[model samples]
Target: MDFEKIVSDHKCRSCIISVERYQDGGFGNIRVVAANKAHREDSERVFNHPFVPDSPYTDSLPQDKNFEDFMYRCACLGQPLHTYVHVEHMGLWVNMFLLPLESDKENIGYCLYSCDISPYADSEQQASLSAETATHVLEISIKLQGAKKDDIRQVFRDIIEDIRKICGAEHCCILYHDITNRKYINFCEAMNPQSPLQPDAIYNNEKFYDIANSFDSAIRGSSCLIIKDEHDLAWLESVDPDLYSLLLENGVKSGILFPLKHNDQILGYLWALNYNVEETVKIKETLELSTFLIASEIANYQLMKQLEILSSIDILTGCKNRNCMNNYVDDVISGKAELPEPYAVVFADLNGLKRVNDEKGHSVGDSILRTAAAILSQVFYDCDVYRAGGDEFMLIIKDGDVDETSIKSKIGQLKEKSAIDTDVNFAAGYYIANKGEDIRTAMRLADEKMYIDKKEYYAKHPELKYR
Candidate 1:
């Protein structure tokens, strides 16, 4: 029977090695005579050549002196041998079985069968690994949960470092979603000491979004994506050269992208770059639990921020509420906050809100309030606009020259526009405060001037007064 034919016919990863004895009583070159389909593919990827008749074994394969000695002895003595081998460069652990091929009384060569066994191990080994992985996950969860609100970013950095180490990745990062801007922002990152990328780098430009969209499209409806190398993205490269070039320029040779999701929303993306195959597989298997915990922490952080905003934002006018204004005033009075020079205070009061509320209903009054807030925001886009009272709005502009005449002209235009659109009227006055003057004094002056303007408006339109 032909041993090479027999090895080729096997379903597993098997290769027949022809071992020749030299005239000097030493082993000669080892050559592969035949290999099965699985072994051929593995050889092509790992060694850059498939096993064929008279093909010399490549020197790039990881060398294990003990494994080579065992094969030599098995061929010389015509005995079978078995052992486990670790290929460090490839990050693979495999089981090997070597059997001598003999004809009559002479040993011809050795037939080798190799099977990847990295994912499986003895019961004790499996239990120990599981225990260690569980400990890591628990420790990370505890650290994130107990972290202070101000220290959450640091906690994320620590988590990224841990993930990078666990996955043996060259870099790891979290990309946050900027919903208002429709962009993805790099929130934080961890990188290997030798990596080219920097930590905490922000990516919000058009090129970054193009790359993100390509990855998002490729992994649509999938929980995670794993690209082995550039060849894996042939379609993407063909369809979008800019995106492909961007990724390559950023040193993304191979990586995985995991979306952080809550309910139906994608909160962000978790990225691991240039990890080895074994580590990538391990990460894919174990990351689901850890990512869930991370997503929960992110969601909790977002909720806290939203609560802070809601406490200070006026719902009807979409401006800072009285609570926020009072806090600012207290801060200024207590010397905790310093006002910038050349500041101005603008006071505005709706002219006929009570009449509209009494006759046209509170809904109409609310609409007018919202419209007034919008106009104030548009005119003083660079200043802080606040709803100081039920019918009063205030604006504070700092570090800019006060053009009172121009502001009054804009207000006049707004009055004409509102009068035609909704019969709404508003009166406004501004006071430019001198340096080292009390902010309260400026506010009082602004209010008195606003009252005078209101009186003039009522005198001009007495028929529009409240019933």
Candidate 2:
């Protein structure tokens, strides 16, 4: 590697690390910082490496803090360390305060400090890269504050643009996993962004499960993997040349995939591609730390998605509940959830439900209510079903031409199957709106019609025996 080019471009000192087995089963690295103006090596001078303890540096430590004192003292006494040393242990990196002493400064009891420890983890000469990354993230987040959902996405795009400017990488993808859909949805802020993987807009449940399984296996085995590579690209080229060309044309080179995990489960994976960059694609400590924070953010977004789904779904019947109904209507009124030209609202009331509760036990009544809900849900085809109230259900059908024959057949089947001695009849009224009309008015009309139908039924069957 040409060290000078890296130094010039990134404006930071570079180091090559040689890893050996760690003492406590963790990884350890020996960093040999690039030769700069600061420390011209003298063959006669002796200096202790950062990793070693009990060097001359440990001597100045307070008696109360044994381990840290010993470690620093070791560095001071054993070697001529021109810069501060950092050690990562137990999930924290601690930087020791050290300075290079000049020949005149040593006699004068003073030394010159070279770099800022607060900006970077260790050293004065190397730039504090992670602090810079954090500042960029914070600035972007502040700009996105109080923005709408769409605007927030735009902010993310802007952030990625900044990243591209700094890192000179191509093809970054932010995938939002919909646990409800059991899929990974590609979220892009750019309007009309062409999907590279078309025909498969999202990776479904089975595919997500496969990725999750692979992730778990790798975690257990402590093995790293690159899911997509040149071979995969070649295969895609063989099968779908246009898609392959599209991917290549878009400057998608090598990609780094890290699973976004929450509550110990992988929600999704974030992918960043190298494109034309020649930097080593290896995961660094700083990048790993950033990934942890990113994973948390992604997890939070996924959690909100789940909460949104839960808000819409009825916990009891697995249908759109009252809250969902309200949201649906709001969406329809606001033109968010678009409806067909001719929409129909069917209001249904289960007859003799209160009588059943009065005669039979509440358990039986509960069972009857559940059965009625199930029947209504099963009878309605491609309609939004809601258990609006006790013994009252609502169906919002997008297709206005709901087959009356099919609904009658379903009611007949329920009447035959119901074991309750009382007549298992239900009063239902549907109001179709040909032109765009208020959903509330349609619902009210259907409800009034249902009551009228019930009244007529009771009036005609006055002589029939009551349950």
Candidate 3:
């Protein structure tokens, strides 16, 4: 067969690949037998070397098991395959096609591989999925689009379960990575009830990130890792023995992993364990399409959460802002949130904030406010602290868990500590509201008592002027 003529006829970058077959049903040495002019020219332009014939495919392209597996299936099994993939290392989208070529020799199988490269992904090419795969991907997108802000977490869990069932896997997990912290930020995993896997106990953010980080190099910079058989495991073992052992110990016989990426940033990883090995190709195809939508949705969800935190939290004092306190009060009044039978509302006013701001700069005053918040947080461990306004904080403490005596002692300790540390002083007071009592009443009484206590603070420091 004139392999050169066959590849040369193709318009795009095309090549003839030969796989060395063993008598015992194994394969080795995937070599590029011939390349079209376009392929050779492109190779020369990018790699700064001429594409030589009868060279290892890795010499021309990346050593990707997924690519090798596709070639093997096309050449040896006579199954033509087509896939549109994002080549992560090169930051390019490649539309690839594999067609089995007629081979006269049994020991050597041939496949014609052709690809059109693009800097950006083509939406039409991406949408060219099998009907079943298209349906699955479409359903996920619809669910994500319909989900409300409050429903996002549960919606994500439901999606994970759906993906797990679709892959016929024992478990499916989506683990988000915080690259700056080297931590597993968020995780959503679906598992069979009987599966002997840790639900949330075993792995922490730091401990599991090591194994996750190793997958990039273990796959030799491939976008995803598909460990279908012992051959793939052997490759992993050779590259990372410890990780290989860890997977084996965790009953990971076969798995597929795809990174949840957004705008070239790896948001996290989507992986399945003990999946149906026979459906590996279909699973990969479905997930490749599905992950695109999932990653985008997760990224938007994370962004919204960060915005919500910024809106509800006080930046200076690291406590809930007045807006958050108002919402909580509304929730309690509207019966959206139920408080216990007896509760207390406490007001903590920083006594010397104005004096500090006038004497020193506003930055020093800001530090004093933070110090006051820290002391309040330390004392009111089981309560919510809100920065109601400048130099004023509010706490809603449940009374049954902490009695009045304990609260008074803690307040006394705060006063003594603030006096010793010249940074700040506290004028704190609380009012307990029993069943059938209004929270507004407790808040008003707490505020009045706090004002009364402020006079005592002034008396304690007669030499210093009080505003």
Best by lDDT: 3
Taking the tens digit of each residue's C-alpha lDDT, what string does model 2 give over 1-467? Answer: 43333223422221211222233322222222232222212101223233222222222111111122122222222222232222221222333332322222111121221222232343333234446555655554555454465465665576555544444444455566566766556654222144253222223433443453344333221112232446545644664454455446655555444555565566565555553333222233223334445566556565676798898877666667788788788998898988775767888787776777787777887777677777776677567788786777898877635555655565565455553535356777777776667898889998998888777767887853332
**What tens digits encode model 3's per-residue C-alpha lDDT throughout 1-467?**
99988988899999999998877656798999999999898878887889999999977776678888888888887888999988877878899999999899978899999999999989999999889989999999999999999989899999999999998888899988877777775578899888886535425523466877876676565667888878878887988886677778677788888888788777888988888988887889999988989999989987998999999999998999999999988998899989876788889998777878998989999888888998888877777899999999999987455568877887887787777677687888888777678778889999999999989878888876675
Off by over 4 Å in 1: 1-132, 165-168, 178-181, 191-194, 198-223, 228-246, 276-286, 330-338, 403-422, 437-441, 459-467
Query: Given candidate 1, what's the lDDT at residue 282?
Result: 52
Which residue pairs collide, candidate 3?
Answer: none
Best by TM-score: 3
Model 2 TM-score (2 dp): 0.58
Worst 10 residues of 1 by lDDT: 120-129
Candidate 3 positional error at 56, Å: 1.5
Alpha-carbon lDDT of model 3: 0.85
Error of 1 at 314 (Å): 2.9
Preferred candidate (TM-score higher): 2 or 3: 3
Alpha-carbon RMSD to native, per candidate: 11.2, 12.2, 2.3
Model 3 TM-score relative to the real fold: 0.93
